[model samples]
Target: MTESDGERRPAGELEASVLAALWSAGNPMSAAQVRAAIPQPLARTTVATLLIRLHEKGVVGRSPAARGFLYFPVADSHGLTARRMHQELDQDHDRSTVLARFVEGLGPDDEAELRRLLEGGGQ
Candidate 1:
């Protein structure tokens, strides 16, 4: 899955995996723990890269422990999702076009759920 020289890779799935591992762990975890949690056994460098990216995104919280930085999700799954979405929208761009493309990618159940939420149907 290598790309052209120096192009950034997509980190969404990697970030999601690390966040889920942190949530399930019930405590802060190191990159090693995150790598272990990943079913396919990703490289430690990969997990570390994901952690660094997540930290840069402000979604991963860190603590300076005796060993080193321990990472944890800054928000619950839904909150993190909303935060990431809002963060993306906050970037300078055509908001309507970005949102329209996002909505267009949704499946039926997801679209319906999004509509319900947008319509103030959920808590």
Candidate 2:
């Protein structure tokens, strides 16, 4: 959905957009730069707030800039996905069940790839 719809978006969606802008940039960007890069017409302050929140979450890192700060993702997309997976796993007490169900849900190709990785074949 577009921000023009005047609907409140989930914080995660906003954060993901901010991250996409940063990743595309491949360099630290100021809030204004991020705002311009994103498809959504968010205010500079809103972009800055999202960057600050991402920094707090360890998803992004920042450096002092002449105006405010330049934000960049701490990891690439795949690394972030892995980190999220780990976070989800860490939250559940029944890790074995969670992992089992996760493996069960995988398609054949993904299952083979996972098995290969598990057997240290990918290394």
Candidate 3:
């Protein structure tokens, strides 16, 4: 079904798809270029709008090009994941509880990395 047929996607899903397009390109792309790259049959205007939103969110960077602008991912997958995680953790007033829960959910390797980072070994 099409988007007009009541198929609404979550905000993050669209944002992630846009990011994936940019990431896969591995080079800066204009809004039009991005629109062409995505598999979804989205409107060119819709892709442009999403790129603008991602730019405003600081997840994408843009630079002036010939008649338009070129957009690129500001961070790779891991960096973006860390950014979102930090953003969520920062929103809670109870830092200890939030952090404790986050740590509790980490796997062994992730927990070890966290410990190393906390001890100033990892960066």
Candidate 4:
């Protein structure tokens, strides 16, 4: 979906939170432990489902444990955000169209500033 047209999905929230919890923990944690980190009382099965979703998204890693899967975030939030940003930029098909739309939307002063930056006049 286009960035403007795409609304946030429940799966996205769950995925983000699972990553956050793992980031805060800084270690692999069991499903129950991850669920406890979440604000709400989530069923272990629910967290497991979210974990699976994250794993599919390439944002989390899983390992087998005695009682259940141990989960960890594959990267920190900033790294993940950078990946998403890179994906969005890479997905744009027409480079000229992207630049045209970007410049067209800028105000006069902003446009001038961007020009200067592109010309290596601004640091």
Candidate 5:
């Protein structure tokens, strides 16, 4: 199905929506709650499946609820982003080159902040 049909969405879009919902909720939520929170018109089962996949990927955590489960994001948005950056860095063999390129791509302020962090001035 195409996006116009509302039945289909771009890859990872639903998952991102679900994660956003959970993050905004600031608490574990049932699949039904998540489905209602997200803007997408998805079935509760679909949201549950997305939560399960996120759990498998270690992106979300779940606890047994009275019915099935309540899901929550394992980390805040920034933490997840940093984890993804580490995962990307781990994929490459030439760590120094990747680090250099990443540092080179930073703006002047970001570069200075990184330098300060590296110098143990910022945490």
Candidate 6:
């Protein structure tokens, strides 16, 4: 659906939506710009506040712009996913067990890719 014609997303979906918009823009954007990129109608203030929250979470960076700030993602989607995975891994006491479980759950393709990376194969 277009930005002007979509149902209100559920809780926590807003952050993901906002982040996706930032990633797609490929540059810092003001709250107004972000609102425009989003697929749902969102208030300027709402976007501003969401950006601020993301900034606090270290997911986004902001700098002084015209009147407020231009916000950008601190990491791309892959980097963010890796960071989150590492964060979760760090939370557990049994690191080996956690990693083993994770490895065990990987599909064949992902398992092969992981092995290749472990073996220092760039391709």
> Candidate 4, which segments miss by more than 4 Å at Cα?
1-9, 95-123
The TM-score of candidate 2 is: 0.87
* lDDT of candidate 3 over 1-123, digit per residue (tens): 776788777768877888999999999999888888887778888888999999998999999999678999999999998998899988999999999988899999999998999999967
Candidate 1 lDDT score at position 102: 90
Q: Candidate 4: which pairs clash?
A: none
> Which residue window of length 10 is worst by lDDT in model 3?
2-11
Tell me how far the alpha carbon of residue 119 in candidate 1 is from the true structure, in angstroms, after superposition.
11
- Cα deviation of 4, candidate 5, in Å: 1.5
Among all candidates shown, the one with the greatest TM-score: 5
Give per-residue lDDT, candidate 6, residue 36. 94
Poorest stretch of ten by lDDT in candidate 2: 1-10
Worst 10 residues of 4 by lDDT: 4-13
* TM-score for each candidate, following the candidate numbering: 0.64, 0.87, 0.83, 0.67, 0.90, 0.85
Mind giving the per-residue lDDT tens digits that candidate 5 earns over 1-123?
677775557649988999999999999999999999999887777888899999999999999999999999999989999999999999999999999999999999999999999999967
Instruction: Compare candidates 5 and 6 on TM-score and give the better one.
Output: 5
Candidate 2, after superposition: displacement of residue 86 in Å?
A: 0.6
- Global lDDT of model 5: 0.92
lDDT winner, 1 or 3: 3
> C-alpha displacement of 101 in model 4, angstroms?
5.3
Query: TM-score for model 4?
Result: 0.67
Q: RMSD (Cα, Å) of candidate 4?
A: 7.7
Which stretches of candidate 5 lie above 4 Å from their native place?
Answer: 1-3
Ranking by TM-score: 5, 2, 6, 3, 4, 1
Clashing pairs in 1: none
**Candidate 4 global CA lDDT score:** 0.83
TM-score for predicted model 6 compared with the true structure = 0.85
